[model samples]
Target: MIKLPSAFRTLLGWLPALAVLVFAGMALAQSFQTQIYDPTTRKWVDYTPRAAAKFYNRHGQSPEEFRRQVVPFRTAEKPGTIIIDGDRHFLYLVQPNFQAIRYGIGVGRDGFGWAGIVKIGRMQEWPTWTPPPEMIARDPESAKWANGMPGGPDNPLGARAMYLYVGNKDSIYRIHGTNQPWTIGLNISSGCIRLNNEDVSDLYSRVEVGAKVIVLMQGAALYKGV
Candidate 1:
């Protein structure tokens, strides 16, 4: 048996409580904010998309070409576009009783799969990335937040965010902005649909909260990678 001296015993008694404090401190040490790193200009820009900010050179996009290569808008086929062949990874925005706008996208991994028709429930500029609890649970080193992350360059949501919901139910899937312009037509997200910042901005201007989004399975998926 270990005999404890009075002063020594009191100190040992505090050890358990001390350990708790240390662990608590570590958990609270995590910090997060919107950070920007402009690779081209060599200056960091705010994530917020504003009129004053030009993300890139705006070149003319021919309506015919846009309707052709971008989104075919199904000449005389479906009423709404489809994001078919997620395994192939492409998102199609359908025109009402007309053609479909086709844009390549990066989809979620195996288990995070999603499907069906949703709408652009909400849109935001320079959106923040308050990773979901499940996402943080998967990667704790991330900028963690309980509520939501603020809009900034550092945010994973990039320059814009499109919330996807069914009626009033949040499917947790989003068609949002991406800093990686190269991955515009690649496979890289969890379940969320992705688009280059430039492309997303264009889509944002065109699509509204009530606009329809069809995530389908395309037979052929091909896109140019930058």
Candidate 2:
């Protein structure tokens, strides 16, 4: 047995309490960092670590529902076709065996939603974002980026972007990664389909230019076979 001086023994007894206090302080600081100001709501929203962790697995990746997975999906579309079910917030890449690789997504809000068949006209990695003229008019803050916002972690397009087109013309819509991972499974974008950075990167690698993309907007029936 080890014996210590009276004062030293008292100090040792307080060690566990001190550790608890230190960890509590760290958690409090992290909670504060999650506070974000929302221009639309005109309020500050806070996301507790526990809430964020619920969406993630022990590996720090999205949970099973949000992570990319192969699931039984019956569709007549050929393999390599992309089908987006806006209401369900799911993007499915059709496979040959009546299965598809499904990834969680964030779709457009309300009136911005649209259903159509389009093709992936182009793709880019860490692409720059140039808010269109209409967006600038609707959002004064976007005017500053009329030229273009350089691609980076902070950019709205987190990692990769696939541009959609109608025949020869750009549809002005995209399927891209979002810096705001929490937005997945929500309806909040202008018209783009947003995926978490990791999932989007995976999708970007699997999909190719000229791939068929069918978007089924909220409340709309599944397109044809899809």
Candidate 3:
């Protein structure tokens, strides 16, 4: 075998490292392309579908900053608990080791904001929209949906909904997905805490029925970074 030059040997040594990095990058690209699963259709889906993409594009929205992520958070809640800071427009799923998965959310409008401790009484995939009696009274246009609106892409409750309850009593508030993703990070819902369709689907897969949910009002302490 011929002796290799020092520079050639050095380059050869780096080939393995370079190969590792190339493979790592490929893996990341694959993960980035496929976002999460959609419970509505029981299929894996992209981060943004056409309608959602078009809506966001029309509103000049950039969703990168608001995407869900796991972050270090200081919270007294247990691992399985869900905590919503309405004022901060964030929801935290407490995890072990003082860390939590956080998602940007759309909260109740000014007068509809609320604070309470409740449990996820139930969950629905592609949940139907039933305009409560009071809702119909408030918005007469909702009367068309008096019976119920079947869940679909245009449905107000995007893909999944977690019904909140206070000891068997329906709170009538939901932790659900919104078709209008631009409303996230703002107070604009009718008393529900809403996340993006993909975010809610990811959350629905992680949380089980009866999970503890705490919604904090104005004066409540916010989750500080760890």
Candidate 4:
């Protein structure tokens, strides 16, 4: 039998430990890397500030909940229609071939949901927010903004807003972006539909003025042709 050299045996003995340290280092590096899917480009992009991602992932709403994907949704509405399923917290942009670009949304809280067919009467980028008289009455703190709040990152409306109107009358409801992206997929709005900043921007670009928006309430009939 051949005897191994002492030095060689010592190096071989340390190999397992070295391997573990290397693997641990690799995992630690990967832990800091985070990515999110961009539905607009249909690709994954790096998400900055890993801490925010970790917090969002841990609290509620899986990462997949924010991803916009082409889903198999059979709606009688024709292409170019927007169907908001508030109960399901999903907004479906009807597409060709019985498919839709499904977007997770933040809808009105209990006793605040609405159902109706309205048109996209107007669109605004970085729109000012004015608390209605009733809203200000309920929350006096909002009275400071009674005049109006300028649009910005801190604004309740994140990026874009599409106003809903019924036959040339403002419905006082909107499909708009939210500063609190974590609110997406949650019931926490005051009778408006909320989308992530990126999502609302995307929807705003796709949906033109005068587009039909059908908001569904509990026990509402699904869209059936026209």
Candidate 5:
């Protein structure tokens, strides 16, 4: 047995409680760090995409539901059409034989949600990011990139981008890859649809310019039997 002075024994007895308090404090700090006050919304919002990505990278990938997979999907839309069920955070590339390649996606938050039929106007690899005028006015941070941000791993539009168009006009929205893969399955983007880098690359390769895209927003009629 090891013997210690009275003071040392007392200190040793308090170690477990100290450890619990330390861990609790750490958890509380992390929670606070993950949220931000939104003046426009007058609420605190979860703003932890970067942090979440780091955590998931250390722990594991995003939820199993968000992983890419092939599933039985029945839709009247022809093969090569892209159907996005934003409410469910799933994007399906319609295939022949009542099948589809499904990928988890991050969709528009609250006021930004929309549903419409569009076509792929163009595609780019490692696409540059040019913050829209409205985005710059809304977010000072975006103002720095008003001119443009060159494409790379750190760019928000991770590995690829497919621009959307309504007839001959640009909708200013895109189906793109995201640097923060942890955002998949969450409602977080301004208006664009986001997929993980690997998944986006796979989708980009399969989709062609001028392919039809149907976006179903929340409460919209989702395809049956998906």
Candidate 6:
């Protein structure tokens, strides 16, 4: 029978313990994942589920109304046109039958109702929020929002924003991600459509730079064409 030397036996005995320590260290390093920082305050914020859940609960909002504002949609429609149910808070990327990639949305708040067929003219990453001159004029405090608002977890636009445009006009209105995920099912946007940050981020990645976007107020009728 062969036997391990004493020194070799000792090293072998230590391997399992060494492996566990290495794994524990890796996990500890990965514990810090996402960050939300405010340069002005010189602070770093952690994205923890409990903190987010607590913020949602503290807001004077009904939990149901902010649940991504989505409902089942007929996605199998013909591929040429997109179906937007702003009234119902869902957008559908029509396919062929009666189904779609449905997404929850927040429509215009108070006086920001819009009805039209617009194309996605321009797209941006962490878009700068330039308060329309009109918005600044409405309230002097809004001037801070001008000169372009930087993107972050606290930014009203959340992580992503899709700017809707008509021919020569950039609709002051937008379709964007919101920090206020709790406001999802509600029509509480100034003039833009709101989406959960993750959802909007996904949508932004799927849609292209010049995708044709058709936003509708009424539920689309069954398209009866080839």
Q: Which candidate is the best by TM-score?
A: 5
* Pairwise lDDT winner, candidates 5 and 6: 5
Q: Mark the 10 consecutive residues where model 2 has the least summed lDDT.
A: 24-33
TM-score of each: 0.58, 0.70, 0.69, 0.70, 0.72, 0.61
* Candidate 2 structure quality by residue, lDDT tens digits, 118-222: 899999999999997878999999899999999999899889999988776576679999888877766677779999999999999999999999987644322
All-Cα superposition RMSD per candidate: 15.7, 23.8, 22.9, 23.9, 22.1, 23.3
Which segments of model 5 are wrong by more than 4 Å?
A: 1-55, 219-226
Better of 3 and 5 by TM-score: 5
- The list of candidate 1 runs beyond 4 A from truth reads 1-68, 71-85, 95-99, 218-226
Steric clash pairs (candidate 3): none
What candidate 6 gets wrong by more than 4 Å, as runs, is 1-81, 218-226
- lDDT per residue, candidate 1, 74-180, as tens digits? 44434443354465445565667555566555555433444466666788888867776766888887635657778776667878888886676555568887655
* Candidate 2 backbone collisions, by pair: none
Score candidate 2 by lDDT. 0.76
lDDT sort, best first? 5, 2, 3, 4, 6, 1
lDDT by candidate, in order shown: 0.55, 0.76, 0.75, 0.75, 0.78, 0.60
Q: What tens-digit string does per-residue lDDT give for candidate 4 at 1-226? A: 8899999998696675445434422332111123466677998765443433454778644367556778998878888899997766789999999999988887765445566788889999999999889789999999999999999998898899999877776766799998888776665777789988888999888888988999876633222212
Model 6: pairs clashing at backbone N, Cα or C within 3 Å: 74-99, 75-98, 75-99, 75-100, 76-96, 76-97, 76-98, 76-99, 109-189
lDDT of 3 by residue, 90-188 (tens): 899999999999998877654566666789999999999998787899999999999999999989999999998777756667999877877776666
Rate residue 64 of model 5 by lDDT. 66
User: Which 10 successive residues of model 3 have the least lDDT summed?
Assistant: 25-34
Write candidate 6's Cα lDDT for 113-194 as tens digits: 4456666777777777778686799888879878878988878888888777666446555678777786655556665787
Instruction: Point out the higher-scoring one by lDDT: 1 or 6.
Output: 6
